[model samples]
Target: MSGQLEVLNKKLKQAIDTRKVLETARKQQVDTLTNFAAKLSLSCKGMDIELDNRLAKFRSALSKGVDFENLAPLIAEILSLLKNQEAQQLSHQRELHTSVLTAGKLLQKTKGLPDDTRRMLRHLLDHQLNEIQSTNDFIPILNKLVSIYNQALNVKLSVKNTEDSITQPRLAKELLTLANDLVFEDEAADNVKAIKNKISETDSVEDLLTSAIEIIRIVATNISDERQSAQSFLVSLNQTLEDLHHSIVATSKHSESMSTEFETLNKRIESKIVNLTKQTQDATSISSLKALVDNELKSLSHDLIAKERLEQEDRQALIKNFHDINTRVGSLESKLSKYKKRLHEQRFKSLLDGLTKLPNRAAFDERFNHEFHLFSVQESDFTLVVIDVDHFKSINDQYGHSAGDKTLQVIAKALQMSIRKSDFIARYGGEEFVLLMPGMSVEHATAPLEKLRQAIKSIPFKFKNKSVQITVSVGATQFKKGDTPLIAFDRADDALYKAKKSGRDKLCINS
Candidate 1:
């Protein structure tokens, strides 16, 4: 009996020792994880102040099991921030490269010029282009280029005779053409054409130099407008991406915290089991053993009930977390949906003219192609009306670009009011608009356009408090079987030319 007792005690002691070792290992593991989290928190402080705060909170509450889930969320947030930073860095690099290339190309283009002019352009490029940090900075450099180019215009080219005296006009024309290629703004285009006209009409060096300088200024303005548009879109996209990343970090932290609490509770229950087992070894008699067992069982029952209550609380907490996650997900989805819609709107806007707020040439091409495809498949006919505002240049020259813009807007509104719901309108280019009338022939299309032309002539467009009237010439063409959009467009254009030749404000339709 004594030997049996000794053996039982020995085995029980082994069990106790085993449990103690396990508990020691568990503590070490917890300590190691806590230390790692603390180090991570400290290391991340310099990266982002807000993220560092979150990580610090996570580290502070780790011992209490309150911040258990925050580790992963913090990591995710750090990664997201890094990714965004990387993207921004990459964009900056690209812009830098572009600046270098632009300057290099400009330098090469002006290499044939006199040493003083070439040196001045190079100095502008090195000083202004190299220092460009933002779109705003970019505009000043372009302005500097405008000044340099204007000065370059006055510098005489090497001329040998009377024939070579024409070099000034020819060079001015070449420079204007190059400027046109660099910029494509509406006002810029008009100025370019006007300069080209002036270059053709005047042979004097002073007149050519004046027109050339104006072209450079117009080009600079156009470049600034383009850069601003690009920068705005980039800013909007980056902000949206940042918002999404923040939401992801928040949700991950909440989930991690819940898991930590549950783990802590389980560890406590394991410790209680070890303590109960050790107490069983103190039983000396059968009755005492039975009593000890009963007490242990009662204690266990109480613990089990407590555990059940804890489990219930945990379940409720889990459900709440799930609900929170669901709500957050809903919010994110809604935000994503709105972002998608805005993105689509931005894409649509890009296909539109900035000045007149109408669909531009790109939009017209898409619609024309779609309509042409349908014409091939469904064998349906559609008419194209190519309308041009008559004497439009005179309006811009007489009342300035603002008045010209207002006149075009009035003309566009009149065209919109005159068309049916099924018909579509697009501003093809400056002073030109295209109308697509589905299920309408050339004869049928003429009536609506004629009325639209008269309607445009009647618009009392007040520019600088002056009541101004405008007129438009219309040319209509019915899409033929096996015809391309360009072919149809050319026929309509030819008809428009005929209308302009015959008289202003008349509608001409191709047979």
Candidate 2:
């Protein structure tokens, strides 16, 4: 029994050792699976849920005392998942590398950007694209790229716009050609020329640092050297523009003053003519002369011969006075004719607008007064049309004043073509035009004016390589008896205001 007990204790000890070995092996397998799963969790940061679930199932099997037969397959499946994850990671890495390279190329292509801005773009391209490890992280970088691109494009467009406005293309091209030749000839340093040549070969911003710094320094030195000259030119330009504006305003005022003075002088001459004609008619009246002659005979001698002689002398004296008065009136009429001729030929020319070659406000005033007088005398029908260019200020603002001038010219031409020879057109002021249609009532004038409105709208105005449409608001009114020309004009102007307020490009008649 002692021997049997000792044999059992030995067997028990051996069995315990074997069990310890098996338990150690089982722990190692669990640890291996756990370590693999942890590695997969780290690698599959954004992996599919199916893969995660499979990994969870393998872990659950391991925790439930999985046999080697089952454990081996689970491990094999885990190994397969790991391989696929690695391949996916490799593909993502390659894609990221390719994207970074693409960004580098884009950075290289960008030119004329300031150093700080270019550096900011490069920093984003280099760091942002590289740090992205998954699809979810790519969006911000793409959006950042779009913003950077827009900023760069805006800067380029602004610079181009300013350059185009300030510099004439043909002159700028010539100047640039001359500058290039002078730069090459005047450059004394071989190192600078070599650096410039090197920079000229490359389009990349990264490769241009040294050349750009040197160019900036040279530009700074040149600017410092020419600062006084540049300031003088700028001052001269500003002074010239101011002088031009002042001159225009002063000339307009002077023209208006001259027109008013001429009108006053004409009225004075007409009044003098009327007074002289009345005096002549009163002196030559038959009843007044007979009464005067009868009184003179009563006071004269009773003898027939003396009375006849006195009567004959009085008749000759009266004839002489009448002849003298006629001669003076003829001279005055001749002088008035010459004055009218001079006014039409010379003064009216000044009253014409230089831009559109249309009659200006001064001329318009004279014509308006003449028409008013004619209407008063003949009682003929007449209409005044006041047309205003719509949003003219915006056209000038968007496309320089030159373009605005062109638009005015085109509109003026169109109006001239649309109107009859008897009708008169004038540039009343800045963007306002007046038309005088005589012998035509408001109803008769509307059709032609509407046609003119349509013609103006149809003109496809092109300025600086851009297409624009033009429209006008028209006002029409008939001349009424006992109403001043100015009052009639105001009514037409009011109609024009209504037309403009009511979406423009239509005719508003206030008759």
Candidate 3:
């Protein structure tokens, strides 16, 4: 009986040792699981903070306006968070599996122990496995929330960008059209109407964008809430679905309203554009017809004037020829008179220009010499004028020589119109022209030259279906009693140089 008591005691001691080992293993497993849960919770909290920060930044961007380009980075961060969560959960499961396997091995080693103790150890291991599986299930739902949130944010950003892009150009076009219409319209009511239409169109787009932003904000908040409640993923997902359904309904209503507003605004703009287009077409037609009629009238008037000028020129030529005949007849009666008569006629013809039939440089030189001789004899004064066209070469090069020639003729005609009948004009060469006035001072010559300058400047010469404008520089010098023709010419040339240097298209007088 004493021997039987000793064996029972040994069995009791072994049982106590097994319980101690199991207890120690259980505590270690609990500690490991607790540490893992703590770490996972910390990671989750960190993820939450990061998500919050990202959302805040996104909100800030949305408040100002969403940037589509930034959406990719947001998505990348969310994906990284999901991957990290998944990896952590997987690691936790692996650790738990390893712990369970180690506990199973410890149980197998104590197979000789009573069944109740073995069952208790198995129950604890099963509970831990169930907890680990629950946490694992939670992780995928969290990742899905993250993905949904990212997708929603991306969609919002895309819509915002698209809306802005669409609206901006329309606003700009409306503003420009309104400004143009306002400038063109004579009536105050018309200007007000255009301005109001532009404002309405601009406002409609802005209001649409504002509504879209509000909707996006609502959706983002809902998604954010769903992300935070990872354990209740299904419930959160259901709530999100409800929110989405409500959003869709609201969006449909908003779209209908927006469509109505757009239709109204579009109709108004289209009507205005049509009306303006018709008005522009009518104005253009009237302008073209008026231009044609005016051109015809101008042609008729020019023909009449040219005919009268030709007749007058012919009479003058006839008179000149008749006078020459009378002089020749008188000279034929005497030997010395014939030579003198031929010389005078030759000199007179040499003094005249071939083109424009105006006085040439020879005439100006002869007149200047005679005048200076007279001034020296009588102390009288006379002015010499010189004119040069500006950028004549460029015009010739750009528009061809024919245009240049037409430009020259137009300027010559303009000069004739501007100058006094007594003023003698000449085409000096290529683009240089000259004028001379007898019995006039430099100050007196300025008026006619300036008139010619301004007239030429204002008159638009039509060439190759384009209106071309040109300017000229003029210089004048008053002849002194003692001045020779060369001296007067040099002084005029110097004044012309000064005129060109000061800036072309101005009159300069020799001091």
Candidate 4:
């Protein structure tokens, strides 16, 4: 009985050792989870406030050696928070992609953006946006935007005004009006009209400028077409004239040659007649006379045959000449008609203003150059004048542009009626007019310009059912020896500046 009790005690000791081992392993597993949760909580800090709070709570509970069963819900809560943040981030990145792409396109066209900077931007847009998935992909674009902003500020401070430097809002509006006046052909015309249609008072400057660039390209193409047509017409006309000249010389030579041929033929016929008469006189019998007459008739026929061939050749040559003349005349008539039509088109499209029906800047340039040439050669009296409507912007602002346009139209008519027939007037640009007064010195032109100013001031005008009085400032200058058109124009412009400065409704002259 004592031996059985000893064996039982050994078994009990073995079971106690096994329980202690399992308890130690369980404590180690809980310690490992708590240590891992501490690290995860640190990473989650500042990710989101709610995520940080939930992670902090989960980490605190984990430190208490919570079992996996009790910790599963907190782990699930952290996952949900992380997923919501990821979705919000994705939403933000999508919107950013659109804005960045659009901005890049516009910055590429900015006039003053440096080439190196532009190249970098282009590179970013081409390589980055194609498969962009996150905000990190736009890092290069973010860097470029800062650079572009700085460069734009530099350019704005230094950029001087030019034809393409249309910065003012009104300048764009004015340019649209002038752009519409240009006419092109076929697809080119439609392209220009399409671009013009896109223009509006409310469009951004970059959009409007982009449209302007496209319109300029279309206009340039039309000009090229016109040049090619004119060149072809000139070449054909020259060839036709040269051929007609050669034909005329050939006809003159042929007439003299024909006259000489006629004389030779007449002499040959007379000689034949003399020979026949002598032969007939020498006949001794009736039969011999008949044989001699037949022989003489055969010889005369041979001589007449050669003459007939020469006459036939002359008739064929004359027929060809007439045919050539008729064909050339028809060709010339057709070309002249086409040339006339082109010239009319050129005059209307290139030289006349669409709105006021007056001569435009190009016409002014042509006339000014021609008149200056005459002035230099003849040393005659020639004057140039510049006129500006007083308070024109005020009129437009208060009464609207339509009323302002009417005022300009009436003002243009009044100025036209006041000028002499020999004098020329043109719309220099917006709210400005230029005059070329031949046969008038600065002294003579001053009085007339003042009178014209007074006439413009007295013109009765109405806008928006209210009466408005219009006035003008005049500046005049006369051509002198060794003066170019540009010099004369500058003088008139300077005088105009003085007139406006002295006060409205004034006339100033530069000799």
What's the TM-score of each model vs. the native? 0.46, 0.35, 0.33, 0.55
Candidate 1: give the clashing pairs.
69-256, 69-257
lDDT of 3 by residue, 1-511 (tens): 9999999999999999999999999878766754564454445555456655654554454445345476568657756766776787678777756755564545445424446545544555566345646455545434533443454456567778888887764654334322222211134335443443444344466654443454345446545753664335545445545654655565456556655655665565566556555555666477775765565556556555655665565566556555654554444445335445755765565665533445665666666567677778877557888889988867755765446656777788888888777677777665778787877888877787788889989987776788777999888898876677788888998988899999898999995
What TM-score should be assigned to candidate 1?
Answer: 0.46
Could you list the CA RMSD of all candidates, in the order they appear? 46.7, 27.0, 41.7, 13.1
What's the best-to-worst order under lDDT? 4, 1, 2, 3
1-511 per-residue lDDT for model 2 (tens digits) = 9999999999999999999999999889878877776566556644766677777776676557667687787678767877887798779877866875686567557777678767767777668767877766767776766676787788789888777555443332222222222221244334344554554344444455555566557656655755865566556556655655655565556556655655665565556556555655676677775665565455333334444554565566556545654655565566557656854765555677755779877789999999999999998989999999999878865775556667888898999999999999998766789999999999999889989999999998887788888899999999998899879989999999999999998899998
Candidate 2: C-alpha lDDT: 0.72
Give candidate 1's total backbone clashes: 2
TM-score of 4: 0.55
lDDT of 4 by residue, 1-511 (tens): 8888888888777777887887788778757757876896787699689999998888788767676788899889988998998998888888898788888888777788778888887887898677776778778668777787678767766675433454555655665676645656578767765665556433366777787787778767777887999899999999998888888778778878987997898798889899889988988999999998898788789879978888898888888887888788888889999899979987777787655668888899999999888878899998899999989888866865556667777888888999999999998877899999999988887778888888888877877678888888888888888787888899999999999999878898877
Q: List runs of model 3 lying over 4 Å from the truth.
A: 1-349
Instruction: Give the local distance difference test score of model 3.
Output: 0.63
**CA deviation > 4 Å runs, candidate 4:** 1-171, 180-203, 206-287, 298-324, 398-400
Candidate 1, superposed: residue stretches over 4 Å from native: 1-300, 327-331, 334-338, 460-469
